[model samples]
Target: MLAGSAIVFGGVFGFVAFKNHMIKQFFATMPKPVVAVTIAKAGLTEWRAVVPAVGTLQAVNGVDISGAMSGLVKSIAFESGQDVRKGHVLVQLDTDVEMGDLRSAQAELALARTSYDRSATLLRSNTVSVAALEKAEAELKVRQAKVAGLQAQIAKKTIAAPFDGRLGVRKVDLGQYVQPGQMVANLQDLSLMLCDFSVSQKDLGLLGIGQAVRMTTDAWPGVVFEGTVAAIEPLVDAKTGMVSVQARFPNADGNLRPGMFARIEIERPSGAPVVTVPASAVAYNLHGDAVFVVREDAGPDGKTVSKAERAVVQLGERKDGMVVIRSGISPGDVVVTSGQVKLEHGSLVSVAASDPLKTAAAGAVR
Candidate 1:
């Protein structure tokens, strides 16, 4: 019975050994799984840091054209949306009454001048008393003042453009009565535009007069309007701790209008070299921002293979879809920009056929 039991045990042990050897051989022959991913080489680039803010565009010179005096509109001199120069007649109000008064005052002034001349001549010959000559002189001055006032009244009724600008729709029509301080139309100088925005007090030091600025508006997408820092408020807001900044942009084409919402970017005059990569490569999580770096290694079969290794990185500003990598990776390192989901710490990887950014753009169009 002992001999029979030994034989049975040996047979069972042999069977188990053969099965394990066959399984090992089968696994060794199979290929390792690899993930296909898009990658970009980290490169050194100028670190362009920008301070972003939102603001509203305003014409450098803009105002609601209003009337200084009330009268019936005799004629409209400019059409709606007309470009006008300084002192261009915009509206002419009826000035017949003032003109009539001016003529009467002028006739009185002529008589006063004659009387003053006669008084001076009489005083020279002692033909008139000193008091009488002085009284005649005062009367002549009063008449002259009356004539000037009437003439000014007539000029006030004829409203004209205060500056060179483009006019909005005409609010006053011919024969319509307009009151003093009432808006006749809107006038704006479109040759230059100004945008007022606020930035944190800490960034105030980064700003200066003539610093380069860039702006974009919903009205003109994909078009960048270049400008400069025109003015910086000397005082910071006590409540918000923000400093007001004004940028001036050239708008010779008149594309920018007053009150249009704008996105502004103030560029730093100086920059440092930094390592950069596509923005898609970053994986943000509770732990930290990390990127998958591609590395080459020898597989078990003595064949070279690419592997993905997670690396934590400190990020800086992002511009033009590329992000500045402040730490963790150096220039010339390959990073996975897309298809990172299938990767692990040492997962095998292969370069994808097409760029992920290009693919995404194409997909968006579709």
Candidate 2:
């Protein structure tokens, strides 16, 4: 009985060992897939970097119209928001007082001239003493100077436009008293406009005078305005580490106004061709960036299967959700845009007909 029991126990142990060995061999002999892959072709590529900034629009020539002499406004020749030309009469102040003063000065000047002439004649004829003639001449000169001063004051009462421009809201009305230096209205030469903005010091190398620029303002959506760089500041701001720049734009229609905020963009030439891939395809690590490429090889059954292989690549600029690849990959190479996290080097894979990557799914594959 003891011999029979030992035989049965030995047979049971052998059966268990055999089953475990077969299971191990079966797993080992499983075939790795030969992945289907697309080949890359050489082509031209462009790389560009953009700098964005917010700025304000201004007129090339803007000024505030003011009174030069204190007086009541007699007549206003311009309406609010009206256009005027250089030397055009804008305001006529109450000239009654000024005119009265001018007339008095003219009469005094005539009297002085007559007295000086009589003194000269009498002195020449020996009828008047030299000291009396000298006194008369000095008094006559004083009266002439006073007349000239009054005439100048009269001219100051009339205000004229300094340049061709549009007028702002009127600050004073007809018959309103305005003091000297008081702002009567704001005027801006909108025939040409200027856009002022600042950029980082690092980007200064890319900028130059006369470079083309594009701009947009919230007030006019979907409208693009073009301009050219007019000037670059000689000095940079130390605190912000930025340099100021101004761009000029023709505004013959007078649509653009001073102090309107704008968004600016500058165009630059592109450099050498760069490899680009969808941004979603890249896997980032502390060491470097990497992507999975689908590799393929023929199997014993003469059919192809897919496998994933990790490739390290260098990155450049990013635009439109696509990143420029500097090295380690070429254009048209099949890359794993999705399912990267679950993949390892030389891992077997099954590619579904549907695009697993959100980027590729949005558009047709190139």
Where does model 2 exceed 4 Å of error? 1-43, 48-52, 129-137, 278-314, 319-322, 335-366
Instruction: List lDDT for all candidates, in order.
Output: 0.88, 0.80
* TM-score for all models, in order of appearance: 0.84, 0.72
Alpha-carbon lDDT of model 1:
0.88
lDDT of 2 by residue, 109-207 (tens): 788889888989999899999998888889888888888888788788889888999898989888888999999889999999999999999889989
Model 1, 46: alpha-carbon shift in Å?
2.0
Candidate 1: stretches off by over 4 Å: 1-33, 354-366
Clashing residue pairs in all predictions, respectively, total 0, 4
What's the CA error at residue 39 for candidate 1, in Å?
A: 1.0
List model 1 lDDT by residue over 1-366, tens digit each. Answer: 999999999999999999999999999987768999988778777566889999988999999988878999998889999999999999999999888899999999999999999999999999999999889999999999999888888889988899999999989887898999999999999999999999999888889999999999998889999999999999999999999999999998889999999999987765767788888989887999999999999988798989999999999888788888889998877889888888878889999754656334212211
